[model samples]
Target: MTDYDVIIVGAGGAGLAAASAASENGASVLIVEAAARAGGSTALSGGVFYAAGTSLQREAGIEGDAPDAVFQYYMTLNQYKLEASLVRKLCDDSPAAFEWLRSIGVEFRAEDLYMSGVDKVRRGHRAAGGGAAIAEALEGSFAGRSVDVALETRVETLLIEEGRICGVIVDGQPVRSSATIITTGGFGANPAMLAQLYPDAAIHGDQHWYIGAPTCRGDGILMAQAAGGQISAANRGLLLLTPGFAKELESYVPGWLMMVNREGRRFVDESIEYSVMAAVLGEQEDRIAFGIFDEASRMASKTTSYRPAPNWTADRLDEFVAAGTLEKADSIAGLAERIGISPDVLHTTVNRYNDHVSDKADGGFFKPASFLRPITSPPFYAARICAAIICWTGTGLRIDTRAQVLDAADRPIPGLYAAGETTGGMFGECYASGGASIGNAIIFGLTAGREAAALARLHAPLAATS
Candidate 1:
C-alpha cells in the first residue's frame, strides 16, 4: 500500500487544484485519474470565469461591482433555485479565486461582448484558447512538486475504518492515506446512470452529447454513497445546445441559427443569454430541440458574434447537407416536409415572425429582433439539435461548507472529503454564471486538502501525547 497525506480521486480541475494546495502547504498528495490526461472537463470547457468586482476588472480600469449586485443578478436569473449561502459564497470568493489563478500564472482576457441572451453585467473572463490554457498553467505550477499524479488509475472504492475514510482501493489494491478527496465529475456520460437518474430524458436517442471525458463514470459518487454519504437533487443537470450532426462525435458545434421545437415554433430569442437558452432547451421533451437556418444564416455565421464550438463551420454544414445528415430545401415548407414536420405550421411560423419584424411587435414569442433574421432565404437548412448534456450532473455526496462528506444524518463522515462534482449539490439547484463549477471545485478542494492535512498532523501529536 502506498501511503500519503492526501489522496485525491479524479485529476480534473478540482483534483489538480487540491493537489497543488496540499503540496504548497507541505503535505504529500496523490492524484489518481482514470484517464491518461489530467485536464478532464476543464480542458473541454469554454474557460470563461465570471466574477464581478474582480481584481482583474479593477486593473483594467473597469469599475468594481458590489457582491450584492452580483448576488441579485444570479438570484433573479436562477429564480432562487440556488442555495442562498452557496450563491453568496461564490460571489464573495470569486474575486479571490481569480487572484489565486493569476498568482499561479493563469492569465485571462475579457470578452468583447456579453454572451447573447443571458442577462448579466459584463464580467465574462476567458483564458487564452479557453480551458487548455488554464489546464496548462495548472500543470506548470506542479512541476517537480511532491504531488504525485497517477494517470490511467481508477479508484474502485473508498476504504473506511471505524466510520472514517482511511484511503481508497485502486485497481484491486489499497492505497492508504489519511484523507481522500473525491473530485470525479458527474454521470452525464453514463447512459445507464442517466436513464436511472432521468428516465424521461433518455427517450430521445442521442439527445445529449457527452462533451466531457468518458472516464467521468460517477465512481466517486458511487464510492461515497456506499460509505453512507447522502446525495441531494439528483435530477438537476446543466443542459447545453450543440449544432446538429455534431452529436455523432459527441462534441458541441455552436453557430448562428434559430432553434425550434416539435411544433415548428421558436421558443426563445436566440440573441438572449445561454443560460436562458439552456433553461428553454431543458423544457422540451427528451430535452431535444432543432436548429433551423438558411444559406444566408450560414453566410452570416462567417462573422457571427458568438462561436462557442470550433467544429462549426460553413464547410461542415455543406458536408452535413450532402451526406443527408442535414436537410436543405428551396423553401421553408419543403424543409419542414423533409424533417417530418407540418409545412403549413412552419410556413405560418415564419410568416408570423416576419409580421413581427414588420409590425415591430414581439408577436407572443418575445424573440429579440437580433435573432429574428427571417428564415425566408433560399436553400433553407434544418438540423435536429438537442440538449448536449455535458455529464456534470449536480448530484453527489452531500458535504458541508468545509467540503467534508456528510452522512444521511448530516454528520461528517470522518476523514472523508469531497470536492468538485463528487460533492454534489454545492451549487444547490441552479448553476450560476461561468466558472462556478471550476471555482467551487478549486475552493472546496483546497479546503478539504488543508483540513485533512491538519487532521493528519494532529493524529501523530495526539498519539505522542497519549
Candidate 2:
C-alpha cells in the first residue's frame, strides 16, 4: 500500500492543477488517471475560458464588469434554475481563476469569442494550442516534484474509515491517504445513465458525441452515493443536435444544412443559441430533424468564418450524399419528397422564411437575420440531424471556498479535495458562458491543493489502520 498526504483522481485540467498547487504547498500528492494521457476533456476542448472582469481583460483593454452583473446574467439566462450560492462563488472566483492560470505560465490571447446564442458580453479567453497547450504547461510544472503521477490506473472505490473518506482502492490494492478528490468529469458519455435519467430522449434513440470525455462514466457520483452521499435533482443535461444523417449520428458526418422538424417544416431558427436548439429538439416527438441546405450553403461552409472544423467541407457533403446517407434534390419539393414529407408544407415554410429574411424581420421565429439565409438555392440538400445529448454531471464536490470535498453532513472530508468536472454542484443548473468547466477546474484545483497542504501541516500523525 502506498501512503500520501493526498490522492487526486482524474489527471485532467482540474487534477493536474490541484497536484501542482499541493506540491508547491509542501504536501506529498499522488495523481491517479485511468488513461495513459494526462489531459481529460480539457485537452480535447477548444481551450476557451469564460471569465469576466479579470486582469487579462483589463490588460487586453477590455472593461472591468461587476461580478454581480455576471451573476444576474446567469440568473436571467437560466431563469433562476441554478443555486444562488454556487453561482455566486463561480462569478466571484472567476477573475482570480483567470489570473491563477496566467501566473502558472499558461498564456491567454486577447481575442474574445462570443456565443451569440447567449447574447451576452464577449468574455472568452482562448489558450494557445487550445486545451492541449494548457495541459502541457501544467504537466511541465509538475516535473521533479513530490507529486507522483500514476497513469493507466483506475480508482475502484473509496476507502471509508468510521464513516469518513480516508483513501481509495486502486486496481484491487488499498492506497491510503488523509483525503481523496473526485474530479472524474461528467456523465455525458454514459449511455446507461443517460437512458435512465432521460427516458423521453432515450425513446427517440438520441445519442451524444461532443462536449465530454469518453471516460466520464459517473464513477465519482456512484462512489460517493455508495459511501452514503445523496444525489441531487437529475433534471439538467442538455442535448447537441447538429446537421447530419442517420438518427442521432448525423453530427459526425458531413452535411451543411438548416435544421427542421418531423412535419418536414423548418421550425426554430438554426443560427441561435445551442441551448435553444437543444430545448426545441428535446420537445420533438421524433427527436430527429432535417438539415436543409443547398450547394451554395455547402460551399459557404468551407470559408474560415463559417467552418467549425477543417473536415467540414463540400467534398465530404457530396460523398455522404453519394453514399445515400444524405438526400439531394433539384428543388425544395423534390427534397421534401425524398424525405417523405408534404412538399406544400415544406415549400410554404421556406417561402415564409425567405420573405422574413428579405424583409429583415423574424416574425415567426425570432432568430437573427444574420443566421437566416434563404434556402432557395439548388440543388437542394437535406440530411437528418440527430438529436445528440451532452449531459454535465459530477461537478465540483461540496467543498468550501478552498475546494475541499464535504462529507454527507456538510463537513469537510479532511485532506480530500476536488476540482473541475469532478467537483459536483459548482455550476449548479446553468453552464455559464463558454469555458466555465475548464476555468472552474483550474481555479478550484489550485485552491484545493493549497488548502489541503496547509491543513496537512497542522494535523497530527495519521491513526494506524489494518
Candidate 3:
C-alpha cells in the first residue's frame, strides 16, 4: 500500500511549504526529514522575503514599483542564465506567497529595504521574528492539517519502479507514494560534497569553513542524482567574506577596512556586496584576504549588514584582538610584519589609500567618500578574511518551472518533483540576495507541492489498479 499521496523529503522551508500545499490540494502528505527538526538552513536565515505588489509595498508609500520591475531586476542580475519562465513564476507569484504566509501565521513587516543585487526596488519584507519565526510558522502550519511529518528519518534511497520514482527507502523500510518531492536544501555541511562539487573552494585546505546548518549535507541531491536527475551548477555556492575562525563575523565587514590579498594589496571596493567580495577573494593568492583597519576607523564605523555584528563594542573588539584573530601593530610596517606580508608594499598601499581618503576619492575602486576613512591611527589591525559558505548552494537537480525533476535529456521523470536549494538553475555564479533565496524557496516549494499533489491525484486510480 502507498504510504501517502505525496511524500516530501526534508523538512526545511521548502519541504514544509510543499507538505502544506499538498495537504491543501487534497493529497495525503508525509514529510521525512533527516534532521531532528524541521528548519534546515531556512532557520539560520534572516527570513526576509523579496516580494513585489505586497500590501507592505503600498503601505511603504512607494509608487509605480510593479512586479514586472522586480522581474526585470532579477533578469539583469542573473544575466538571463536562469529560466525566464521560472523567474516569472517567482516574481509574479511572490506577493501571493507573502500573503499566504501571513494567512498561515507568518508575520512580516512592511519595511522598505534595498539588498545586494537589487537596484531599483525596496521590496525586502522582513519576517517579524527572522528566520526562526518563519520556520516556526511553517512548522506550526502543519498542526491540525492533514500532513504527517517524520523527523530524524534519513531517506537512504529513492524507490524506483521501472525508472519512475514511486517512493523512498528509509532505514531498510520502503514507503511507497504516488509522488515524491525533494527539498533537502544544499550541501554546505558535507565537506566531501563540497570538495567534490566545489573543488576550487577546496584549494583553501584547512582555511575554508561553512556557516550553515550542519544538517545540510545534500541528501536530496544525491538521491536525485542516483535516480537519474540531471545536476545543474553543482559547483556554485553563496560564499561570504569572514575572519574564518569566528563564524559570527560572517554578516558585516566594516566598509572602512581595506581588504588585501596575500600579496598585500586591495583588490575591490571594501563597500562591495558579499557575493562580489567572495568572487574577488577567490582570485587572490591562497583564496585568502585580510580586512585592514585602524583604531579611528574601528571607533567611527558600525557594522553595516549582518545584524549580529552591527555594534562591535570595545569589549567585543578587544576580545577578538586578545584572541589574535584581529592582529594589531603600532605602524603599517608592524601590521604588515605581523600578517607576514611585505612591509614596504603595505606602507605604500596605506600611503596611497590615505592620499585618496584625503582627496575624498577612490581612484582605483571608486568607493564613495562617506566610507573612505584613512587608516592612519596608531595600532592598525588586519583581520584574516576568508570565504564562508552561507548554505545557498548553487547546485542540484534540474527542474522546470513546474518543479518537475528532469533527466539528462531534460525530460521530466514522472512522479518526481523538487524545490528550494535542492533544485538548481535559480542561482548562477552569484547570490542575488538573502531575500531572493528565501523567497524562491517558498514560491517554488509551494509550486512543487501543488503540482505533485495534482500528479498524485491524477495517478491515484492507476496506482490503485497496479
Candidate 4:
C-alpha cells in the first residue's frame, strides 16, 4: 500500500502549503522536515507577498490593477529572460494564490506597500506579523487537518522504481508513496554550493557570505539532479550587499550617500533597487564598494528612507563606527585614508557629486533629485561594502508550469512534483523587488499539492515486492 498519497519533503512554507492543499483535496499527505521546526527561511522573512488582481487590492480601493500589467512588469524586470509560459501561469493564477493564503488562515493587512521596480499600483501585501505569522498560520492549519507532519526527518534519497519516483528514503528507511514533492529551500547557506554557482563569490573567493536559513543546503536540488532533473540558472541568484559586520541580511544604507568603487569613483545611481545595487557591487573590482556620506547625510538617514525594522539610527551608526564596521573621519581626505582609498580621487569624486547635488541632478547616473545630497558637512563617513547572497539560490531543478520536475529532454518525471525555491525558472535575469519569492512558493506549492493528490488518486498502489 502507498505510505501516503503525497509525500512532501521540507516543511517550510511551500511544504506546509502543499500538505494543507493535498489533505484538503481528500489525499493523505506527509511532510518531512530536516529541521526540528516547521518554518525555514519563510519564518525569517518580512512576510510580503506580491499578487495582481487580488481582492485585497480591490478592498483597499486600488483600481485599474490588472494581471496583465503585473505580468508585463515582471517580464520587463528580467528583460523576458524568464520562460514566458511559467510567468504566464504565475500571473494567471496569482489572484487565486492570494485567496488561498487567506483560506489557510494567513492574514494580510489592508494597506499595501510599493515594492521597488513595480511600476503599477501597490500590489504588495504584508502579512499581519511578517513571515513568522504566515508560517505559524499554515503550520497550525496543517496540524489541525488530516495531514501528518514529521520533524527532524531528513530525506537522504528519492526512491525510484520503473523509472518513476515512488517516495523518499528517510533515516535509511524507504517510505513509499504515489507521488513526491520537493519543497526544500535554496542553497544560500551552503558556501561551497554558492561558490560553485555564483561567479563573483567564486572568483573573489571568501568575500561573500549568506543570510538565509542555516538548514538550506540545496538538498532538494541535489536529490532531484540525481533523479535526472535538470538544474538551470546556477549563476543567477539574489544578492544583498551592504557595509556591515553582521552576518544577518538587514542592510540599511541611505540612498543619499554616494557609492564609490575601490578607486574612489562613483558608479550607479545610489537610489537604485538594493538587488541591483548588490549586482553592481559584484561587477566592481574585488566585488567591493563603499558608501560615502557626510554628517548631515548620516543624520538624515535616521529619519528618511531607512525604515521598518533594523533601522539606521544615529545611535546605530555610532555603534557601527565603534564596532569598526563603519569608518569615520572629520574630513573627506581623512575618511579616504580610513577606508584605504586615494584621498585625491575621493576628493574629486565628492566635489563632482556635490556639484550634481547642487544642481539637483546626477548627470553621471541620472539619480533622482530627491536622493541627491551634498557631502559638504563633516565629519565624513565611509563604510566598506561587499556583496552577499540572500535567500535566492538561483540554481534549482527545472519544472514545467504544472510544477512537475522536468528532465533534460523537457519530459516530466512522472510521480515527481516540485515547488518553491527547489524548483527552477520562476525568476530569470533579475528578481522582482516585492513578495515574488514567497508568492511563487504559495502559488506553485499549492498547485503542486493539488496536482500530486489528483495523480495519486488516479493510480492504484504498486504490488508489494519482497
lDDT of 1 by residue, 1-466 (tens): 3388789899887787777877777777888999989988888876766777777676666785756787787777667766566667767777787778888888775543233225446677676677777777776777787888899988888998788788898778888887788888877777887777644335455655666778888888888999998886656666565555655442233423666777887776655554445656767764656678778766665433354454456787788888877888998888888887778888887787767767766675676555556666799988877655454677677887777888999998988888776766545334565566777776776677778777667564543454
Tens digits of per-residue lDDT, candidate 3, 1-466, equal 6879999999889988898888888999989988888888888887888887887778878777777987777677767777778778888999899989999888766553555353646777888888888989888876787798899888999999998899999899899999999999988778788788866556666766666677788889999998899998656767777675455535557676777887888888887766456766777887788888888876765544444454354466767888877899999888999999999888888889999999999997898788798888888988887776454677778899999999999999988999998877777666666588888889999999999999998888887887
Model 2 TM-score is: 0.87
Lowest lDDT block of 10, candidate 4: 302-311
User: What count of clashes does model 2 give?
Assistant: 8
| lDDT-best of 2 and 3 | 3
- For residues 1-466, write the lDDT of model 4, one tens digit per residue: 7888889999888887888788888888889998989888888887888887888887887777877988888888778888788888888888888887888788876754555443546777888888998899878776656688898878999999999999999889999888999999888777778777656545545656666577889988889999999887767777766565565556445677799999999988877766466666766887788888888876766554333324356778878888988888999999998888899999999999999988988998998898898899989988887765465766688888889999989999999999888877777656676678888888888889999988887865443331
The numbered model that scores best in lDDT is: 3
Report the error of model 1 at residue 64, Å: 3.6
Runs of candidate 2 exceeding 4 Å displacement = 112-117, 198-207, 245-258, 303-312, 360-363, 366-370, 389-416, 426-430, 461-466
Better of 2 and 3 by TM-score: 3
Model 4: how far is 207 from its true place, Å?
A: 4.9
Error of 1 at 287 (Å): 4.1
lDDT of 2: 0.69
Q: Give the TM-score of candidate 1.
A: 0.88
